[model samples]
Target: MYTPPAFRDDDKDSLIATIRAARLANLVTATADGPLATPLPLFLDETEGEHGVIHGHLAKANPQWRVPAIGDGLAIFMGPDAYVTPAWYATKQETGKVVPTWNYAAVHAYGPVEFFEDADRLLEVVTRLTNLHEGARAAPWAVSDAPPDFIQSQLRGIVGLRMPVVRLEGKRKMSQNRNAADRAGVASGLAASERPSDREVAALIS
Candidate 1:
Protein backbone atom coordinates (compact mmCIF):
# COMPACT_ATOMS: atom_id res chain seq x y z
CA MET A 1 0.00 0.00 0.00
CA TYR A 2 1.74 3.14 -1.29
CA THR A 3 -0.48 5.57 0.54
CA PRO A 4 0.24 9.29 0.48
CA PRO A 5 -0.20 11.23 3.70
CA ALA A 6 -3.46 12.74 2.51
CA PHE A 7 -4.93 9.31 1.73
CA ARG A 8 -3.52 7.32 4.68
CA ASP A 9 -6.01 5.92 7.17
CA ASP A 10 -4.15 5.69 10.50
CA ASP A 11 -7.16 5.49 12.72
CA LYS A 12 -7.41 2.05 14.32
CA ASP A 13 -11.18 1.96 14.31
CA SER A 14 -11.31 2.92 10.66
CA LEU A 15 -8.84 0.20 9.78
CA ILE A 16 -10.77 -2.48 11.64
CA ALA A 17 -14.04 -1.30 10.16
CA THR A 18 -12.71 -1.69 6.64
CA ILE A 19 -11.40 -5.16 7.44
CA ARG A 20 -14.69 -6.24 8.96
CA ALA A 21 -16.73 -5.02 6.01
CA ALA A 22 -14.57 -6.86 3.50
CA ARG A 23 -16.26 -10.13 2.57
CA LEU A 24 -13.14 -11.76 1.15
CA ALA A 25 -9.41 -11.30 1.67
CA ASN A 26 -6.17 -12.54 0.16
CA LEU A 27 -3.72 -14.31 2.42
CA VAL A 28 -0.13 -14.22 1.22
CA THR A 29 3.01 -15.84 2.50
CA ALA A 30 6.61 -16.17 1.40
CA THR A 31 8.24 -19.57 1.33
CA ALA A 32 11.35 -21.38 0.03
CA ASP A 33 9.41 -22.66 -2.94
CA GLY A 34 7.97 -19.29 -3.91
CA PRO A 35 5.25 -16.85 -2.91
CA LEU A 36 1.94 -18.51 -2.12
CA ALA A 37 -1.46 -16.82 -1.89
CA THR A 38 -4.99 -17.89 -1.13
CA PRO A 39 -8.26 -15.99 -1.17
CA LEU A 40 -10.05 -16.48 2.13
CA PRO A 41 -12.94 -15.12 4.09
CA LEU A 42 -11.25 -14.14 7.35
CA PHE A 43 -12.67 -12.73 10.54
CA LEU A 44 -10.97 -10.75 13.26
CA ASP A 45 -11.14 -11.25 16.99
CA GLU A 46 -10.51 -7.76 18.29
CA THR A 47 -10.11 -8.93 21.86
CA GLU A 48 -7.20 -11.26 21.20
CA GLY A 49 -4.00 -9.26 20.91
CA GLU A 50 -2.81 -5.67 21.10
CA HIS A 51 -3.79 -5.45 17.46
CA GLY A 52 -6.15 -8.41 16.87
CA VAL A 53 -6.19 -11.98 15.67
CA ILE A 54 -7.39 -13.23 12.29
CA HIS A 55 -9.13 -16.59 11.78
CA GLY A 56 -9.92 -18.55 8.66
CA HIS A 57 -9.35 -21.84 6.95
CA LEU A 58 -8.05 -23.27 3.70
CA ALA A 59 -8.68 -26.55 1.93
CA LYS A 60 -6.55 -29.36 3.28
CA ALA A 61 -5.37 -29.97 -0.25
CA ASN A 62 -4.11 -26.37 -0.53
CA PRO A 63 -0.31 -26.50 -0.39
CA GLN A 64 -0.08 -23.02 1.12
CA TRP A 65 -0.58 -24.39 4.61
CA ARG A 66 2.10 -27.01 4.21
CA VAL A 67 4.95 -24.68 3.35
CA PRO A 68 6.75 -22.87 6.14
CA ALA A 69 6.36 -19.12 5.90
CA ILE A 70 9.51 -17.03 6.29
CA GLY A 71 7.88 -14.64 8.73
CA ASP A 72 4.54 -13.02 9.35
CA GLY A 73 1.73 -13.72 6.90
CA LEU A 74 -0.22 -10.87 5.35
CA ALA A 75 -3.97 -10.60 4.91
CA ILE A 76 -5.25 -8.11 2.35
CA PHE A 77 -8.78 -6.83 2.66
CA MET A 78 -10.41 -4.56 0.10
CA GLY A 79 -13.42 -2.34 0.49
CA PRO A 80 -15.50 -0.35 -2.00
CA ASP A 81 -13.47 0.66 -5.05
CA ALA A 82 -14.27 2.70 -8.16
CA TYR A 83 -12.42 4.11 -11.13
CA VAL A 84 -12.31 7.87 -11.36
CA THR A 85 -12.08 9.41 -14.78
CA PRO A 86 -10.47 12.76 -15.44
CA ALA A 87 -13.79 13.83 -16.91
CA TRP A 88 -15.16 13.80 -13.37
CA TYR A 89 -12.61 16.31 -12.18
CA ALA A 90 -13.17 20.08 -12.34
CA THR A 91 -9.44 20.64 -12.88
CA LYS A 92 -9.63 18.71 -16.15
CA GLN A 93 -11.87 21.39 -17.64
CA GLU A 94 -9.78 24.34 -16.45
CA THR A 95 -6.14 23.19 -16.72
CA GLY A 96 -6.51 19.84 -18.51
CA LYS A 97 -3.90 18.52 -16.05
CA VAL A 98 -6.07 16.02 -14.28
CA VAL A 99 -5.46 12.32 -14.67
CA PRO A 100 -7.60 9.31 -13.92
CA THR A 101 -7.20 7.49 -10.65
CA TRP A 102 -8.99 5.10 -8.31
CA ASN A 103 -10.77 5.54 -5.00
CA TYR A 104 -10.82 2.66 -2.55
CA ALA A 105 -10.28 1.44 1.02
CA ALA A 106 -8.05 -1.43 2.07
CA VAL A 107 -6.39 -2.96 5.13
CA HIS A 108 -3.31 -5.15 5.44
CA ALA A 109 -2.69 -7.25 8.53
CA TYR A 110 0.58 -8.97 9.29
CA GLY A 111 1.13 -11.70 11.83
CA PRO A 112 2.65 -15.10 12.45
CA VAL A 113 0.59 -17.80 10.77
CA GLU A 114 -0.52 -20.85 12.73
CA PHE A 115 -2.09 -23.84 11.06
CA PHE A 116 -4.01 -26.58 12.87
CA GLU A 117 -6.22 -29.56 12.17
CA ASP A 118 -7.42 -30.50 15.67
CA ALA A 119 -11.05 -31.46 15.37
CA ASP A 120 -12.21 -29.53 18.42
CA ARG A 121 -10.50 -26.28 17.50
CA LEU A 122 -11.48 -26.68 13.87
CA LEU A 123 -15.10 -27.14 14.87
CA GLU A 124 -14.97 -24.03 17.04
CA VAL A 125 -13.43 -21.95 14.28
CA VAL A 126 -15.96 -23.21 11.77
CA THR A 127 -18.82 -22.43 14.12
CA ARG A 128 -17.74 -18.85 14.74
CA LEU A 129 -17.05 -18.22 11.08
CA THR A 130 -20.44 -19.58 10.15
CA ASN A 131 -22.20 -17.35 12.66
CA LEU A 132 -20.33 -14.26 11.52
CA HIS A 133 -21.58 -14.49 7.95
CA GLU A 134 -24.92 -16.15 8.50
CA GLY A 135 -26.03 -13.71 11.20
CA ALA A 136 -27.19 -11.29 8.50
CA ARG A 137 -29.87 -13.64 7.22
CA ALA A 138 -33.38 -14.12 8.55
CA ALA A 139 -32.86 -17.87 8.90
CA PRO A 140 -29.30 -17.90 10.12
CA TRP A 141 -27.58 -21.30 10.02
CA ALA A 142 -25.07 -22.80 12.41
CA VAL A 143 -22.39 -25.45 12.06
CA SER A 144 -24.16 -27.51 14.63
CA ASP A 145 -27.29 -27.53 12.49
CA ALA A 146 -25.87 -30.29 10.35
CA PRO A 147 -25.58 -33.89 11.48
CA PRO A 148 -22.65 -34.45 13.84
CA ASP A 149 -20.96 -37.06 11.71
CA PHE A 150 -21.40 -35.02 8.55
CA ILE A 151 -20.03 -31.85 10.12
CA GLN A 152 -17.10 -33.76 11.52
CA SER A 153 -16.32 -35.22 8.12
CA GLN A 154 -16.58 -31.83 6.50
CA LEU A 155 -14.14 -30.33 8.98
CA ARG A 156 -11.60 -32.99 8.09
CA GLY A 157 -11.28 -31.61 4.58
CA ILE A 158 -10.04 -28.18 5.72
CA VAL A 159 -7.22 -26.82 7.86
CA GLY A 160 -7.69 -24.05 10.43
CA LEU A 161 -5.69 -20.82 10.39
CA ARG A 162 -4.92 -18.44 13.24
CA MET A 163 -2.88 -15.30 12.89
CA PRO A 164 -2.35 -12.97 15.80
CA VAL A 165 -1.89 -9.58 14.20
CA VAL A 166 1.42 -7.91 14.91
CA ARG A 167 0.74 -4.87 12.78
CA LEU A 168 -1.99 -3.26 10.69
CA GLU A 169 -1.89 -0.78 7.80
CA GLY A 170 -4.85 0.84 6.16
CA LYS A 171 -5.41 3.13 3.17
CA ARG A 172 -8.47 5.10 2.12
CA LYS A 173 -8.17 6.93 -1.20
CA MET A 174 -11.42 8.86 -1.44
CA SER A 175 -10.46 11.94 -3.44
CA GLN A 176 -8.84 13.40 -0.36
CA ASN A 177 -5.90 14.56 -2.46
CA ARG A 178 -8.19 16.59 -4.74
CA ASN A 179 -9.35 20.11 -4.05
CA ALA A 180 -12.80 20.60 -2.60
CA ALA A 181 -14.40 21.40 -5.92
CA ASP A 182 -12.82 18.43 -7.67
CA ARG A 183 -13.78 16.15 -4.80
CA ALA A 184 -17.35 17.35 -4.95
CA GLY A 185 -17.43 16.72 -8.68
CA VAL A 186 -16.10 13.22 -8.13
CA ALA A 187 -18.71 12.51 -5.50
CA SER A 188 -21.45 13.73 -7.80
CA GLY A 189 -20.20 11.66 -10.70
CA LEU A 190 -19.82 8.51 -8.61
CA ALA A 191 -23.20 8.95 -6.95
CA ALA A 192 -24.82 8.99 -10.35
CA SER A 193 -23.04 5.86 -11.58
CA GLU A 194 -25.04 2.71 -12.31
CA ARG A 195 -22.71 0.50 -10.28
CA PRO A 196 -23.73 0.07 -6.66
CA SER A 197 -20.06 0.02 -5.67
CA ASP A 198 -19.59 3.44 -7.19
CA ARG A 199 -22.43 4.76 -5.07
CA GLU A 200 -20.69 3.30 -2.02
CA VAL A 201 -17.49 5.14 -2.93
CA ALA A 202 -19.52 8.31 -3.37
CA ALA A 203 -20.98 7.97 0.11
CA LEU A 204 -17.52 7.49 1.58
CA ILE A 205 -16.26 10.58 -0.19
CA SER A 206 -19.19 12.66 0.95
Candidate 2:
Protein backbone atom coordinates (compact mmCIF):
# COMPACT_ATOMS: atom_id res chain seq x y z
CA MET A 1 0.00 0.00 0.00
CA TYR A 2 3.05 2.33 0.09
CA THR A 3 2.24 3.94 -3.23
CA PRO A 4 4.34 6.77 -4.54
CA PRO A 5 2.66 9.82 -6.01
CA ALA A 6 3.33 8.64 -9.54
CA PHE A 7 1.80 5.22 -8.86
CA ARG A 8 -1.18 6.25 -6.76
CA ASP A 9 -4.60 5.46 -8.19
CA ASP A 10 -7.28 7.91 -6.97
CA ASP A 11 -9.92 7.15 -9.61
CA LYS A 12 -12.99 5.60 -8.03
CA ASP A 13 -13.98 3.66 -11.14
CA SER A 14 -10.49 2.22 -11.50
CA LEU A 15 -10.45 1.18 -7.86
CA ILE A 16 -13.81 -0.58 -8.13
CA ALA A 17 -12.84 -2.25 -11.38
CA THR A 18 -9.79 -3.79 -9.74
CA ILE A 19 -11.85 -4.98 -6.82
CA ARG A 20 -14.53 -6.51 -9.04
CA ALA A 21 -12.00 -8.37 -11.15
CA ALA A 22 -10.41 -9.88 -8.06
CA ARG A 23 -12.33 -13.09 -7.44
CA LEU A 24 -10.74 -13.75 -4.07
CA ALA A 25 -9.75 -11.50 -1.15
CA ASN A 26 -8.06 -11.64 2.20
CA LEU A 27 -10.16 -10.39 5.09
CA VAL A 28 -8.11 -9.25 8.06
CA THR A 29 -9.16 -8.08 11.49
CA ALA A 30 -7.48 -7.16 14.75
CA THR A 31 -8.54 -9.09 17.84
CA ALA A 32 -7.68 -9.19 21.54
CA ASP A 33 -5.92 -12.50 20.99
CA GLY A 34 -4.05 -11.42 17.89
CA PRO A 35 -4.59 -10.63 14.21
CA LEU A 36 -6.87 -12.95 12.28
CA ALA A 37 -7.18 -13.37 8.54
CA THR A 38 -9.20 -15.44 6.12
CA PRO A 39 -9.24 -15.84 2.38
CA LEU A 40 -12.71 -15.64 0.91
CA PRO A 41 -14.70 -14.90 -2.20
CA LEU A 42 -16.27 -11.52 -1.43
CA PHE A 43 -18.81 -9.55 -3.44
CA LEU A 44 -19.34 -5.80 -3.52
CA ASP A 45 -22.73 -4.14 -3.15
CA GLU A 46 -22.13 -0.81 -4.84
CA THR A 47 -25.63 0.44 -4.05
CA GLU A 48 -25.47 0.04 -0.29
CA GLY A 49 -23.40 3.01 0.91
CA GLU A 50 -21.71 6.21 -0.19
CA HIS A 51 -18.60 4.13 -0.83
CA GLY A 52 -19.93 0.53 -0.99
CA VAL A 53 -20.55 -2.58 1.08
CA ILE A 54 -18.74 -5.93 1.05
CA HIS A 55 -20.41 -9.27 1.71
CA GLY A 56 -18.98 -12.72 2.28
CA HIS A 57 -19.15 -15.71 4.59
CA LEU A 58 -16.90 -17.85 6.72
CA ALA A 59 -17.24 -21.35 8.01
CA LYS A 60 -19.17 -21.44 11.27
CA ALA A 61 -16.18 -23.01 12.98
CA ASN A 62 -13.77 -20.31 11.79
CA PRO A 63 -12.65 -18.48 14.92
CA GLN A 64 -12.24 -15.22 13.01
CA TRP A 65 -15.97 -14.62 13.11
CA ARG A 66 -16.15 -15.31 16.82
CA VAL A 67 -13.57 -12.75 17.92
CA PRO A 68 -14.68 -9.13 18.23
CA ALA A 69 -12.79 -6.80 15.96
CA ILE A 70 -11.69 -3.60 17.69
CA GLY A 71 -12.53 -1.33 14.74
CA ASP A 72 -12.54 -1.62 10.96
CA GLY A 73 -11.58 -4.67 8.93
CA LEU A 74 -9.40 -4.71 5.84
CA ALA A 75 -10.17 -6.61 2.67
CA ILE A 76 -7.33 -6.95 0.21
CA PHE A 77 -7.96 -7.49 -3.52
CA MET A 78 -5.07 -8.26 -5.85
CA GLY A 79 -4.99 -7.98 -9.61
CA PRO A 80 -2.51 -8.96 -12.31
CA ASP A 81 1.13 -8.84 -11.14
CA ALA A 82 4.43 -9.49 -12.84
CA TYR A 83 8.16 -9.25 -12.12
CA VAL A 84 10.03 -6.58 -14.04
CA THR A 85 13.69 -7.14 -14.80
CA PRO A 86 16.19 -4.36 -15.05
CA ALA A 87 17.09 -5.68 -18.47
CA TRP A 88 13.80 -4.22 -19.65
CA TYR A 89 14.81 -0.72 -18.55
CA ALA A 90 16.60 1.55 -20.97
CA THR A 91 18.17 3.33 -18.01
CA LYS A 92 20.01 0.13 -17.13
CA GLN A 93 22.12 0.49 -20.27
CA GLU A 94 22.47 4.26 -19.98
CA THR A 95 23.60 4.59 -16.35
CA GLY A 96 23.35 1.05 -14.93
CA LYS A 97 21.30 2.52 -12.09
CA VAL A 98 18.02 0.74 -12.61
CA VAL A 99 17.07 -2.17 -10.38
CA PRO A 100 14.38 -4.79 -10.65
CA THR A 101 10.86 -4.03 -9.48
CA TRP A 102 7.33 -5.36 -9.72
CA ASN A 103 4.28 -4.18 -11.59
CA TYR A 104 0.82 -4.91 -10.11
CA ALA A 105 -2.59 -3.56 -9.12
CA ALA A 106 -4.26 -3.87 -5.72
CA VAL A 107 -7.03 -2.36 -3.65
CA HIS A 108 -7.65 -2.25 0.08
CA ALA A 109 -11.09 -1.65 1.56
CA TYR A 110 -11.68 -0.76 5.20
CA GLY A 111 -14.97 -0.85 7.07
CA PRO A 112 -16.66 -1.92 10.27
CA VAL A 113 -16.95 -5.69 10.50
CA GLU A 114 -20.34 -7.23 11.09
CA PHE A 115 -21.10 -10.91 11.52
CA PHE A 116 -24.59 -12.36 11.28
CA GLU A 117 -26.31 -15.71 11.51
CA ASP A 118 -29.86 -14.98 10.48
CA ALA A 119 -30.84 -17.93 8.31
CA ASP A 120 -32.90 -15.91 5.87
CA ARG A 121 -30.18 -13.34 5.34
CA LEU A 122 -27.56 -16.06 5.05
CA LEU A 123 -29.66 -17.79 2.40
CA GLU A 124 -30.03 -14.57 0.46
CA VAL A 125 -26.31 -13.83 0.58
CA VAL A 126 -25.43 -17.33 -0.53
CA THR A 127 -27.90 -17.21 -3.40
CA ARG A 128 -26.65 -13.87 -4.67
CA LEU A 129 -22.99 -14.88 -4.44
CA THR A 130 -23.70 -18.10 -6.29
CA ASN A 131 -25.56 -16.34 -9.08
CA LEU A 132 -22.81 -13.75 -9.50
CA HIS A 133 -20.09 -16.33 -10.05
CA GLU A 134 -22.11 -18.91 -11.93
CA GLY A 135 -23.85 -16.55 -14.31
CA ALA A 136 -20.97 -16.60 -16.75
CA ARG A 137 -21.04 -20.33 -17.31
CA ALA A 138 -23.06 -22.13 -20.00
CA ALA A 139 -24.72 -24.42 -17.42
CA PRO A 140 -24.88 -22.18 -14.40
CA TRP A 141 -25.69 -23.74 -11.06
CA ALA A 142 -28.16 -22.48 -8.51
CA VAL A 143 -28.74 -22.99 -4.79
CA SER A 144 -32.23 -24.31 -5.51
CA ASP A 145 -30.76 -26.91 -7.82
CA ALA A 146 -29.91 -29.08 -4.82
CA PRO A 147 -32.30 -30.70 -2.34
CA PRO A 148 -33.90 -28.09 -0.11
CA ASP A 149 -33.13 -29.92 3.08
CA PHE A 150 -29.51 -30.47 2.06
CA ILE A 151 -28.97 -26.84 1.13
CA GLN A 152 -30.53 -25.69 4.37
CA SER A 153 -28.28 -27.98 6.35
CA GLN A 154 -25.22 -26.68 4.49
CA LEU A 155 -26.16 -23.09 5.23
CA ARG A 156 -26.29 -23.89 8.92
CA GLY A 157 -22.55 -24.56 8.91
CA ILE A 158 -21.57 -21.02 7.86
CA VAL A 159 -21.77 -17.44 9.17
CA GLY A 160 -22.46 -14.34 7.09
CA LEU A 161 -20.19 -11.28 6.92
CA ARG A 162 -20.95 -7.65 6.11
CA MET A 163 -18.69 -4.62 5.96
CA PRO A 164 -19.76 -1.17 4.92
CA VAL A 165 -16.73 0.37 3.27
CA VAL A 166 -15.46 3.58 4.84
CA ARG A 167 -12.21 3.87 2.98
CA LEU A 168 -10.79 2.56 -0.30
CA GLU A 169 -7.13 2.60 -1.33
CA GLY A 170 -5.79 1.57 -4.71
CA LYS A 171 -2.30 1.29 -6.20
CA ARG A 172 -1.31 0.60 -9.80
CA LYS A 173 2.43 0.23 -10.48
CA MET A 174 2.81 -0.13 -14.22
CA SER A 175 6.11 1.54 -15.07
CA GLN A 176 4.49 4.94 -14.80
CA ASN A 177 7.53 6.22 -12.95
CA ARG A 178 9.86 5.34 -15.78
CA ASN A 179 10.64 7.59 -18.72
CA ALA A 180 8.83 6.98 -21.99
CA ALA A 181 11.67 5.03 -23.56
CA ASP A 182 12.07 2.84 -20.51
CA ARG A 183 8.35 2.28 -20.29
CA ALA A 184 8.21 1.30 -23.96
CA GLY A 185 11.02 -1.15 -23.39
CA VAL A 186 9.24 -2.63 -20.44
CA ALA A 187 6.06 -3.03 -22.46
CA SER A 188 7.89 -4.73 -25.25
CA GLY A 189 9.69 -7.07 -22.91
CA LEU A 190 6.53 -7.96 -21.00
CA ALA A 191 4.49 -8.43 -24.15
CA ALA A 192 7.01 -10.98 -25.39
CA SER A 193 6.93 -12.94 -22.15
CA GLU A 194 5.18 -16.30 -22.12
CA ARG A 195 3.53 -15.65 -18.79
CA PRO A 196 -0.07 -14.54 -19.17
CA SER A 197 0.23 -12.11 -16.28
CA ASP A 198 3.22 -10.42 -17.87
CA ARG A 199 1.26 -9.92 -21.07
CA GLU A 200 -1.53 -8.40 -19.00
CA VAL A 201 0.91 -5.97 -17.40
CA ALA A 202 2.16 -5.12 -20.84
CA ALA A 203 -1.35 -4.28 -21.95
CA LEU A 204 -1.84 -2.03 -18.96
CA ILE A 205 1.37 -0.20 -19.70
CA SER A 206 0.38 0.23 -23.33
- Highest TM-score model number: 1
Question: Ten residues in a row with the worst lDDT in model 2?
Answer: 1-10
What digit string (tens of lDDT, one per residue) describes model 1 on residues 124-147? 888998999999999999887899
Which portions of model 1 miss their true places by more than 4 Å? none
TM-score of 1: 0.98
* Model 2 CA lDDT for position 1: 70
Reference-based TM-score of each model: 0.98, 0.97
